[model samples]
Target: MEATYCAGVLSRGKLPVSNLRKSDHGFQRLTSQRKAIASVSCHLSNGLGESSCKSHGFHGGSYHGGAVGKGKDPILQTRCSAGVSMYGESFLESHSHATEDKIGVLLLNLGGPETLHDVQPFLFNLFADPDIIRLPRLFRFLQWPLAKLISVLRAPKSKEGYAAIGGGSPLRKITDEQAHALKMALEAKNMPVNIYVGMRYWYPFTEEAVQQIKRDKITRLVVLPLYPQFSISTTGSSIRVLQNIFREDACLSRLPVAIIQSWYQREGYVRSMADLIAKELERFPKPEEVMVFFSAHGVPVSYVEDAGDPYKDQMEECIYLIMQELKARGINNDHTLAYQSRVGPVQWLKPYTDEVLVELGQRGVKSLLAVPVSFVSEHIETLEEIDIEYKELALESGIKNWGRVPALNCTSSFITDLADAVIEALPSAKAMTNSEGTSEEMDNDPLRYLVKMFFGSVLAFILLLSPKMVLAFRNHLF
Candidate 1:
């Protein structure tokens, strides 16, 4: 007998119906709203839509196993064999049609000194990164140990920096808030996307977040380093660390990612900064006459000279952009850009922020507005270094008005612009599929790599030699 398949339907206390064809059958297509209905139909061979005949393993009416009603054929089987290949093709077609596109956004940041107790340790972590320290392998190890020792020794002094700023770093709290605000702002635009925050030298590190993206099955990632101004020292370091992590992790070997690198020149960012400065100037007794002082985070001059880090240059560019924005808004005023937070008696980019403040006061500039161009959020540098320390110096030097332009943390327009940047940076789905990526760059020190490789080879050679030397000694003894 020829094996046959049939579609049959049996309702409670009703006679069964079987073997219906496309021309004679009355079956409807499934609608999203009608998912509760228990029904099955088949698109069979010979280009026909057959409602009663089950060409695949599907039968109408409740689809439960065993008999239907008073069971003539106790085992109701549907003979729907639409070949495995065809089914797969159809599944792929449907899946491709159903899938929605998404953009992945990675938020790059400097990990902060967490807790009152963690301040010194956090600074040690920051100073230890090779990108920040630029020491040789042996010297790097020596430097780290010395840095640790120095950190312990200097803890009291650094604590003074923290103590003046309220005894702890507010960076973590502010960054967390910024992340949430950015997320909400993006979602409001109906451009729902994932926003990940990765810090350079702390928890939720770049490596950890990269692993998380792997776990989350995120195929496309766009890195947005939080620094408004791009510096080889700040944004470059973070990007380099991320690149290194990607190179080492096998799971991330094939993932697709892109980098925004910098948005310092973006109009929205410049305008937002300009607006902050303008608002601060409004508090002054004279807005246009007020001296505007812009201070950015300072890096060692050696790093700038050797690596040609564009930190100072980019900061100048950012300041110029903001000033231009201010000028366009009809608020032209004399402004100064100075570097802040130089440690360890080294020559940093000068004239220094503190010195400038004192000079402005001494020159008899009555009102001053200090703008922290480098920081997007209020942290130790802005809160403690400038707000407290420099403000006091200015006040003592006889400047009656001294106030700071607040860091752009969770401001509506600033957050919206950030969200816009994320949207702009998202890779096309096709591009995401073809690209292989991450952010860690190789160490610029060739000697470090050579030493590591040499030591590893030497250790292996010694291990191999040990067993043979022991065997030779044993044979001689025998």
Candidate 2:
């Protein structure tokens, strides 16, 4: 019955689909969007388009499932069974509750230019985000023109970077693999899940993913970004996009959603980093002598100081947790954390990765193992900057041995943990607070500290003055 309802919902509309085909310059943007209707037809018809038919299992001439509104045609109802089909497959099923609840996991990431041509547009998208480039209300109108001009100016260097890294970024490929691995891992645990990769600033944009999710008629959604640590310009931007899109879509607005803001300190995640570091350490003659250099992507310092961004604080804690895990395994090596990918002559998080590498070389540190601690997969930063640019610099600075820890793309333990994190994040109710899952150590901002103290004092006063109002106030805590 659930499978039948899902088929009906998918078949009712011709889904405006975007192809995931590889292009030399990036995704091909066709004028007329292709429909995935044929795929749905194939699923329901079992290789026969409207000819091969079964009982369909629908009753009362209606789908009568969650996808359909009350008093609407039951035929329009949507239901997918768990473990019944993979995402993008014909059957949409959930493993939870007799497959009544369909789960959609949207994997978010900062997409890179697929080719040289895509560099400018990608940059435009990046800079256009209000979180990335803050503007006063009076100057808001200049955002587009400024973004355009900046993209045009930055395109050459950006193109060069992409060209050096095989003329594009493999972020899409890596993200796709991550999605598949996560889906399979969840399925193994009897959790029906379909993974969708939604890149900010590229093909399969958040908007595209939102349309796809609506068409899929997902009952529940998990917005799990690829960035392990949350940042305003990355995860927060994506979340805002989702929130705005869902607000406009009636169907999506009613859907239950659980968002995992960050999972940098997950035990499995930290262990995965530790394992990679250990493996890389084996390449050196004396592993203990090698520095475990953690290179994380940087953000403008203003983001932290003015905008109340907790990115750096979270990153520092993430590094600390990974070191703790490494220590538990009895592997101790000198370690340091530095920020990379600073742009546009603004102050960013420090110490800078490049500066640190040069200093280490000058200090006669011949052996070092570089770690892309914040990056889950290899991209321009890791492949071109770290491997090519940084490596060349290290060699010129007299560093004899230099190696980088491999990214945790589709690592079994890491994927398993990703699945677990999503499952744990899904709430029995409509929403769950991120503070419940995120480590308290990440909340180090003075503003939050002040807020907590103020609230504590207020609560005490209320308790002393009016004990009866306590229950009323308790309802507003969340």
Candidate 3:
């Protein structure tokens, strides 16, 4: 029996798909207009998609699964077993000319400036995101104004960094390469699908990608954030955007969408990071003695403490996985993880990368290797911050020799693993439903909107002015 769930029943954000790199340049990329299909439920043929999601025996780092809904969507559904790799030989065999199965893989990433002039606007877009500044919801209207102020303040130094790295951040260029490579890898496995790059803050924004997906009439979409680990400020922000869009758009809401939350724990990714470290280690005079320094982009401690972001845990586990691979290969020197690119006065995750570098130097550790574990592509963080700034800090701190591991950027092994991740996530794709009505349908209800907003504003004002009243009212109710 095909069970039909109500639209938006797959609640608490599971129905959505989802980073900013969470770098100095990270003021955080991507305001995350990246949210997809709010309140969407699964509609797998024969309930295979739901069952396989659990039967796969993976938790935490797997594709999001949702409750199934009736077909307001027109795409023909099929049984998608976890064990089934139908996207391969059988995919090509059965659907030799299957143009109907339009699968769009939207790769979400932090966008950086293309030139010196773009730096301020890019920063403005980033800081304009509430995730970057993190004010209470009631204060949100001030976001753009404050963002402009901060972006102006931040631009000069940021511009200097960009200038140091040849007048722009190569994030867009490198991300494009990764997208192309991922497409090729998928094509090789006979899973060719259109891949689209959605940068959060730059040109070809997530909104643009969504528009193109609509124009192309994409049947299935895989929202894949390039960030390997999940953070509230990065991946969560993007997911939120997608959810809003899904809620508003009739066509997108009904479209089948699958999201890969994070893939740092994937075997191939760990091995590939190890491969880079191992290859880089050979450069030092004594590979066995060189201390491996894992410098990941930092998020606020409050994100973990208050918001319960899994970033620190996931990052630690990712490093552990890679180090375990290295240990298995008998390359166990010594390693430590530190958080870097912290902005603002508030405390970020520590030990801070710069402070740790100085501490390592004072402790007499020489020939250290800096692995940019958080970022996958060469951007401002990897190129200028780690390569230039941190290197200078290390040399000044008395570290005799310093080496930095490069970003994964279209590496054969890394690209292959990403393709594998996409293939694994395909079985769990859940289509958005039109049963909830379209954005246009909702817009038709203007009086309802005004009443809601008017009351909301009144409530916010009350909360803003009368805390004591709220407390007294609550006590009286009790």
Candidate 4:
């Protein structure tokens, strides 16, 4: 039933713009229902707003779906009569109240080319980002020309890649499915939400999303990047661009925005990943014998070394946590993490996925399950780079069997998890980070390292003393 609901949403991905506009009424209905339950206003990172969101309901405010709650916000306390049966009895019944505060969720991702002609320009937009190609401030002026040159040189090969993957990338389709699923999930939970998709460098770009958000008159905004693990080049670049645009406009500059930078550690996200792996493992005759290979998208090494980007660190930790979750599920298969999609003459995060595959093949690890860890939706990276190119490489490298985990696009559990993250972020969303290192404070803190080391030693000692007790210790630590 959940799969059916997800399928319904996926089908909507191809809907024309006119049809999508028609769906606004459904979102407004959701907003009106949610406004009845909660009246609390936006909670600012700097400080709480002087006037509550509830105050606008009675003030003849021009906001869409008017203020939701009058005195107090009731998130899930009141049950409405509207809910899908697939969500079970726990979902709140939908109700209506006057509201002007419409919750707008902006989904951010690196948009892909829809045709071969778009490949070069997409590549240019990607390489043009200073985050992708680091340049000293004095030399930054060269980025545009350099990006142009690289895109021209790389376009033919990239065009072939898209050609193999049905002549385009399915990223936008998958992302739209995710957006629709999230909207349903939020509405089921009795929250007013309208989801907007914003691709960084292609059609429906960030600027376009902002324009739509403004046109719709969204009262409060929640920015959720599709990247689970935060990276300076990906999430950081998107958020920074968005905040800069918001600052330029008087209305948007004053609009309250909540930011969910990353959710790599979220339990539901980990579980959804584990579930995908488990399903993939079932395809193998000997599931336990197959090795788990996590292939994350790579970034220039200098981004981490010189710019203090914590992406590499976050990727490592994310892999560890996912493995831990798999272990908890009693799947103790050997696993390896490698980076993929490297570009240019410069070194990227290593060991490269292709290199790792070659080494594994030489070592006679015959069966393998490749997981695309950095991406949540199907794109050229997964369709061409992993499934096509790497699969052929793996099979030719003497691997008897090979498989790749499907991207988690609109999976019910993952969508529910996203809805929770959005709801949690709305109340205390901070402005996007200004500097690259700002997001890495907790990761770089000396005390954090000391505590981790202390706990690591303790766990090791406990394992040596009593293997059984390690289970208890693990439970406590988690």
Best by lDDT: 3
Candidate 3 — number of clashing residue pairs? 13
Superposition TM-score, candidate 3 onto the true structure: 0.72
How much lDDT does candidate 2 score? Answer: 0.61
Enumerate clash totals for all models, in the order shown: 8, 10, 13, 13
TM-score of every model versus the real structure: 0.68, 0.70, 0.72, 0.71
lDDT of 4 by residue, 320-424 (tens): 666766777898888877777766555566677787788889989899999988889988888888999999999888899999999999889999988877765
Q: Could you give candidate 1's per-residue lDDT for residues 1-101 as a string of tens digits?
A: 00000111111111222222122112121111222212111111100000111111111110011100111111111111110011222333433332354
Question: lDDT per model, in order?
Answer: 0.56, 0.61, 0.64, 0.63
Candidate 1, residue 113: CA error in Å?
Answer: 2.2
* TM-score between candidate 2 and the true structure: 0.70
lDDT of 3 by residue, 41-95 (tens): 2212110000000111012111111111222221122211111122434333334
lDDT-based ranking: 3, 4, 2, 1
For each candidate in turn, give its C-alpha RMSD to the true structure in angstroms.
26.2, 19.9, 14.3, 17.8
Worst 10 residues of 1 by lDDT: 1-10
Candidate 3 Cα lDDT to native = 0.64
